[model samples]
Target: MFYSNSWTKCLICLIFIASGNAECPKPQVEGNVVLTNEALLMNDFPEGKEATFQCANGYLKEQGSERITCTSGKWSTLELTCKKKDCGAPREKPHLKYEFSEEGTLFGASARAICDKGYQLTGPSYRQCYATGWSGRPRCDVVTCDKPPEIMNGTITEKPGEEFPEYGGVIHYSCNEGYTLIGNKSIECNEDGEYNSLPPECKDVNDIPLKPTATISITTTSSSTVPPTIRDVNDIPLKPTATISITTSSTVPPTIRDVNDIPLKPTATISITTSSTVPPTIRVSGRNNCVGEHDTKSATENAAVVGIVISTVIVALIVLFILYHSYKRKGSYQMGEDPSRTKELLQFQNN
Candidate 1:
């Protein structure tokens, strides 16, 4: 009974001693970091001791002692710190834009990339945040198109032998002489590596028959009045030319006149006018539709003929007037000089 009572008394004393008699203060939290959520469980802590530190989430430990030593009656000043990592701005790419997911450019973050219209993403489209920095460096470039199709009897207008024409680039075509252009005159290279239209074809101008046409223009006076304006809608021809002549009472059409050749000016004019009883007559034997937009509006065959006719009539009238005046002067001179002599000579001849 005596031993049991003694043991009970010693246990009570030990409990009272370990109850953290407030002899040493515990360590407090530091710099936005918290330790275990549990209440201070230490029964007692002696001077010259240590307690560990921990960093909160999304923060890294700085280069310092993670534990703080307890000195006599107080805790040591904190040596450890929690800091954040920063990856500065990313590199810029042409025609491309980027945005970060979070305001912080720290590790484990990401960035989204987008390209402008008519531009394509060539390299990685997205970048991820790493400890060093952004992982991928993306690129942007304009949409590309391949070489246009070759044309038959025609040539495309492009830099010779240049392979690629980017999107929205244009190509023009022109046919050889006597050949007409079929399909589009020009095509555009699109982003799909194809042209907007098929290649144009050149047709032989001589394959279609042409008829004779007559245009008679006469100028009675020297007036500034514009003669009837004409627009030719004919195709242009190529080089190496030869003259062709056709004669008829109707309008003369030089056969196979090169569509590419510029029409020559009339060589000369001739005038042939009949009496007023006859009006000028001009005839066109065939269909007459002049088809040429580029006009070499020099004097035509009919215009030359009209000018000749007017000039001839004026010359003939002047000649007739001069002859009549000469005849009248001769008769007047003979009458005045030979009136007296005329009677005397007649009488002598009769005897």
Candidate 2:
């Protein structure tokens, strides 16, 4: 029983000693201070027990006691003085916006960067303010582009072709007749001063199918005629003859249906009136100056003919007037000479 009692008393003493019953230890250095992240929850500390201390972010210890001892169950007042740690303001970036986690730009503070709309970020999005400087230096810039370049033998399929090609603008290309596209058909203007793809080329067409031709030889010595056979480019004779009608002068090959991105044959039709006949008209010598299919008159020639007819009418009127005047004068003279001669004549006849 006595041994059990003694053992219990020894266990109680160990617990009490572990509960800060000893005197606080002296400071390691008189005035030097060291920063710590540990927390202090107890109001009183036993002798030989120390409490750690540290300077807040953006500040450094100029001088002071890092740890204090609980001498007589009481700690000495803090002698440490914290000085500000200054890092220059975050690197200036034009057109860039920033959001800081803390109000102060002191050490250990962090900031986030965001570029303006239509602009792209070049570096890290978040940066921390260090004692030396900012963690990442970010910048903002405007990406611009001039009018889209012209492509040879090809046209831009974009509607209302824009004069200025801005970032992310897309342009589609297509080759002209008798040419084939050789590269990317669509390209986009990128952030950098460049395009997503090299402009396509319009290569000359070379693989078109060749039409068939037949040769006939007429020999006087041969007694029988030999029929010529029609064949295709592959030298294969086609059977079951088919006939098709066309009016246009164009001879472009028909494109395959849904194959090779080819185009279809033109479906245009032209109608001619059967009863129309050629009209009589004077032809201009220098050029085919006929303005319309129905207009038969030439303004220049019509004016000249009108002037000649008017001149003829005027000359005929003048000639008729002069003839009437001469005939009247002759009749008047005959009237004046008559009477005296009449009497003498009558007398001579009677005798």
Candidate 3:
């Protein structure tokens, strides 16, 4: 009976040892909290054992202790709170602005870079937040354009000291002498780093048209009651009245026919109109002469004929004057009294 009691006591001791060694399942905490290296190696925790925790990657501890105790095969409630790490704002740059992604400025979030007006972004346009801060370095640069196009017979002028034009820059154009510009004289660089329009052309001034020349005209009219009559030089008749009408373009007075030289019919009427630049002169022979409608001539032609006749008369007068003086010096001035010579002189005067 003593041996049986010893075996029973040994069995009871084994059961107590089993109950004292109770273990808790792998530890689990809310949020980004995770077990330390030493605690994670073990699959389960013994009763009364303590485990330490910290924030997960990209997360930071916010509140409460980092340690918890296991009791009665369960882990103690965890009070540790964690949140994502914030990267804050990006670095400031000239003509550059940033816009955060949907993840905000926290760790692992991304941002896009934007340039201001007349500028462009260079290098990477996107940057991501990391544990060490934002990644990538970007820059904003002014937009630039190549040399402006050349125009025919024209020159382009730009600002001094500039090899190439920048955004918003202006260029002036000019044409050579005797040439006119055909388009805008100035051009501006656009946001795309190009001229806003095509270069202007140079047109020759001679291409312009000139005014037309004025025209000259002539008109004539005449009136008579009976057919024109030709009179003989020997029969002298009373001077008849003549109605003369003259029209001319020149400011100078027109040359009219002498009343004694022109013997016209009583009912004859003459109207002359001319648009010539020069005034016209009219003359008629008195001996054996008659002026009718068909006798009219152009103002220019009449002027030329009158000039020739006046020149001939002047030369004949000079010759007659010299001959008379020579005859008087030779004592032959009585030659005019001879009957035959007198008749010849009268005939010449009539002609």
> Best by lDDT, which number?
3
lDDT of 3 at 246: 57
Instruction: Kindly give the stretch of ten consecutive residues in candidate 1 with the minimal lDDT sum.
Output: 274-283
lDDT of 1: 0.62
lDDT of 1 by residue, 209-291 (tens): 44333345432222132222333322222222233333223334445444433234432233322221212222222113453
After superposition, candidate 2 runs with Cα above 4 Å error: 1-23, 26-58, 61-74, 81-88, 102-104, 141-149, 153-351
Each prediction's total of clashing residue pairs, residues at least 3 apart in sequence or on different chains, is 14, 5, 0
Give per-residue CA lDDT, model 2, range 267-351, as digits (tens).
Answer: 3233322222222223332224334322323444676898999999999999999988996665442444576675665567567
Residue pairs clashing in model 2 are 23-47, 23-48, 24-47, 24-48, 25-48
Q: Residues 27-84, candidate 3: write the lDDT tens digits.
A: 8756688889988887768999899999987889899999888887888888889889
Q: Which residue segments of model 1 deviate by more than 4 Å?
A: 1-66, 70-83, 102-107, 160-162, 205-351
Higher-ranked by TM-score: 1 or 2:
1
Q: What are the candidates' C-alpha RMSDs? A: 22.0, 28.0, 23.9
lDDT at residue 210 of model 2 (Cα atoms)? 32
